[model samples]
Target: MGAVDRYLQEQHIDRYAFLPFSACRILQPHKLRNCGEVKTVLLLLTPYYDGDAADRNLSLYAVPRDYHLFFRELFAGLREAFALDHPGASFHAFADSSPIDEVDAAAKAGLGLFGDNRMLIEERYGPFVFIGEVLTDADIPCESGEVRECEHCGRCACSHEVCLSSLTQKKGELSGEEKAALRNHPLVWGCDDCLLACPHAKNVEKTPIPFFKTDKQYRLTHEMLENMDEEAFSSRAYSWRKRETVLRNLSLHGE
Candidate 1:
């Protein structure tokens, strides 16, 4: 274990990989270069709340509080704390809000394999883990080894055109054809068709994080949104786009 591994272990993070910052620059050049003297990049995978059959209506990712905020809190003061142990180095942390292509970073770091649906698939957490990173000026060890390639088994059953995750977030009212498709679908917020179709998604270990294990919901209902105050709405990932977007989706779903 190196400095990066020690830091992650102390923070209770079990899944991570370290890569040269240069590799992260290649995948998302426009987004990752501005963090200042980033020499090594650490890719961290944190699991989110993944509900079982009762919560099938919601996407696995949204089952927890906004992961962007979750990671920011988890890595709070990490750079300064790390600097205390090693001089002349700076660290910065970012989650999904950053420009880095997290899935690509994780894939390249050998943290997970890329599924046909473009989701990074980990053996333990499947595609439900959130990817975060610590960018550092330190020369952290990077013997993460090769990227694990997916078998490309052509097993993903849902096509993007009809993917409910995209369809529910469509800007305006659903088209006549789209409305016909939603008639039988139970979700108004997001879909997990691809995940449910994945062979690897089955029999994965449940997330061990306390925050993810409790206090989660499987669906975003109009009633739930209507009842929330400003603070409650503001804190959630689902509400970042605002209430109207969800209302629009709910209406389209005939809720």
Candidate 2:
């Protein structure tokens, strides 16, 4: 284990991988300079609280308080630590909205199993994990770990065409076929058919992060949305789309 690994362990973060910063694929050319001075990328698997067995409509990812906020809070300490150690080194922390392709980067770093549902599934946390990164100028070597592939059992229950998540997040009115699908779909925000159907979702451990464990919230009601302020909206994963987008999906199902 290296200093980077020690940092992860000290932070109680067990699921992490390191790769060269140059290996990142989705970052735009202009933004590449943000990481140009960085030699190593630290990929982190941060877990959120999936709700209890309530058959709730919200996606598992949204069960916790805004993860982007939580991740920034979580990684802030690491950034400071790295800066102290490297003296003038730069570090940036990103959750979902960063330009980097987190999933592909995690796969390249041999972090977890790639599922047909297009999620990264780790042994302890399953696939219900958020991928984040800390790009730094430190010369941390990539973890010499094995990357796992999905079983390819062809058991995936959802497709891009019928994926409720994609259709709901899409701007403008829903297509006729999409509206028809929404009418029967169980969740108002995200689709979990593929997640629930995966054998990997079974028998996973609860998240150790205090933010996820102590501050779990499952449902997202119309009342909640009506009361949500800008700060609240800007924190969660679904905030990229406007409030109207969520309301449109909710109204389609009469929720």
* Per-residue lDDT of candidate 1, residues 104-210 (tens digit): 77888888897888889998888778888878788877754555767887777676567777776666666788876665667766787877688888788888776
Model 2 per-residue lDDT tens digits across residues 65-138: 77777777778777766666667777877887776777778877887887877788777777888898887777
Q: How accurate is candidate 2 locally (lDDT)?
A: 0.75
TM-scores for all candidates: the values are 0.87, 0.86
All models, RMSD in angstroms: 2.5, 2.7
Highest TM-score: which candidate?
A: 1
Worst 10 residues of 2 by lDDT: 140-149
State, as a TM-score between 0 and 1, how close model 1 is to the true structure: 0.87
| The best candidate in terms of lDDT | 2
Question: On a 0 to 100 scale, what is the lDDT of residue 105 in model 1?
Answer: 77
